[model samples]
Target: MNNTTHLPVNPYLPAPLALPLSLVPGKTYSQVMARLLNKLFGPELADGELDFLEGKIMRVDVVDAKLHFSITLSQGVLAAADTKCPHDLSIEGSIYDFLLLATRREDADTLFFNRRLRLGGDTELGLYVKNFLDALELDDRIGPFLQMMNGATTLIGRIPRLAIPKLPFPKLGRRS
Candidate 1:
């Protein structure tokens, strides 16, 4: 559990998008996730072990002109990984819907039972990751990463808050 107070400039990749200054938001899964885990848990990985896993886990296979992600989780660490990429969970729905579901962990199992999360591959892996991810509170870890991806500020200056738009609520006004 090594924590990094400052984000080092890793020359191997472009610095992730900054935060707090007004920037567009969209990121490839790998770029956003890699920088995130590096900053939050850089101490957790001493070498390229995580990166190797990154290539191993965060991958999409293409066959017959179709593409799908083949994710593998190493049990227990799933929670930590999810905290870093809450938006990228492989739930059964549009990416936006999945992100919305991710922000609402209390309803995750409900969604899963409702057939809203189309899971594939190892069930045990899914359960392990889901439980671990379910238990985590990752606002602190995710905030900087989101900010960095949004391109406003960086690890420097004040850490920006993770600003996910509030989900729209059902209309309850009296029927006309």
Candidate 2:
């Protein structure tokens, strides 16, 4: 008997791209995320604005994409955690929701309130991270690329979310 299942169509990665994406090494995920995050939050790192993350593990779970990335801050530098170790905090959500949050299309509070994003682990750490995300500002110095990406994300959000069959999505290893 066929065991294929269906899930909402993803406007972000699509079924084809999702497969290969999942095969990427965990180290690569860490490297890419660390580089991008460091670039985006360099000032905060230098100014010690993110010192609270020192020796802390923050895991981001992109459910639809079947990807998990763990990051840590040490000596004011952001790097990827090299193992499948436990996390001090975890932020789980779909790619679309993450895009919305990052693009300022939706605030972190609203997403958590609406249950689109789930926050787990140390409450104190979670609250601090949540506040940080909510307070993120897209200034001109950060440039207009995010604005353009936001437009694209908004358009992608409009795509019908009806279930797509035979998507080959892996079983979600939800945390208890």
Candidate 3:
């Protein structure tokens, strides 16, 4: 069974919008995710620690979003790979599953073993990716931001509903 079969589309992004989301160019995904990846592993990337990933195409599939992108590192930079090239590794899951993994709300073993996240293609590549993620300096990089977000969410949750007011708007239409 597909992990995404019974999983709901992310609340923040509707399923019907998958088509539009998939329409985003591969170049855009490559650039954005590459920059984010570089930032997240700045020291390692700069030290040639990720040179092993060079020329290895890895495909990420956001299942519910119906979006996929293939990328490879080249000259120490991530770049969109030619779609015709076979991916060395493939990972698929719903958006929320990915979020859970990223936020450490759920461990990778749990998600992968539960079938909430799927991996295919080369087993070695999978191991490499998992090891890389494991070695991330998360606390050193994004700890402060996560703390701020957590504080903000806590404060926002305590706000009373009445603190927000809804206003009505009049609609204009053709008139005789």
Candidate 4:
């Protein structure tokens, strides 16, 4: 008799999903991060939500992407440094985990408990930053833009992995 018995797959478990390429090749992490910060922190600055970071240096490391960058608020403006600096706090996590946090798909505590996110340097400062982010309502802050980007991302990920030659114009007259 066979020793193994078939078991049903757990439907509650997350299925593996392919993520579409988003980062541009050859672009330095700082450059990409600068663009992202300009979008994410610009509003926060205007709203005075980032006042606490005015004179603090914070470093964020994207482990899987092998990217590291430092952030500072100078005169209420968010700045990004290419190299690591003497940071008051540091946050480290994989790009996927960071994205989950940004999108409110997961909480910082949950990620921390699971060991997917980490904090170092000044614990108090790190906790302050974490609390600030947790309190901030991202959905209300960048609702439409985030939704559009998320939709586009999902659509791109769902596209078939087909390698077809690029054409300048569509074949308007043909059904195929």
Give the winner by lDDT.
Answer: 2
Q: How do all models score by TM-score? A: 0.39, 0.80, 0.70, 0.62
Quote the positional error of residue 135 for candidate 3 in Å. Answer: 2.1
Query: What's model 3's TM-score?
Result: 0.70
* Tens-digit lDDT track of model 3 for 17-86: 5678888876677667777777777788789878878989998888767777788889997777765578
> Which sections of candidate 4 miss by over 4 Å?
1-28, 144-176
Per-residue alpha-carbon lDDT of candidate 2 for residues 26-137, written as tens digits (9 for 90 to 100): 7789879998989998877888878899999999888777788889998889999964889999998888889888888778887888778898999799898878767666
Q: Per-model C-alpha lDDT, please? A: 0.40, 0.81, 0.73, 0.67
Instruction: Quote the positional error of residue 26 for candidate 3 in Å.
Output: 2.8
User: Per-residue alpha-carbon lDDT of model 1 for 26-59, expressed as tens digits?
Assistant: 2333445445455564444453333324322433
TM-score: model 1 vs. ground truth? 0.39
Candidate with better TM-score, 1 vs 4: 4
Q: For every model in order, what is the number of clashing pairs?
A: 10, 0, 0, 0
- List candidate 2 stretches off by more than 4 Å: 1-13, 164-176
Rank all candidate structures by their TM-score, best first, as comma-separated numbers: 2, 3, 4, 1
Q: Model 2: which ten-residue window has the lowest total lDDT?
A: 5-14
Overall local distance difference test of candidate 4? 0.67
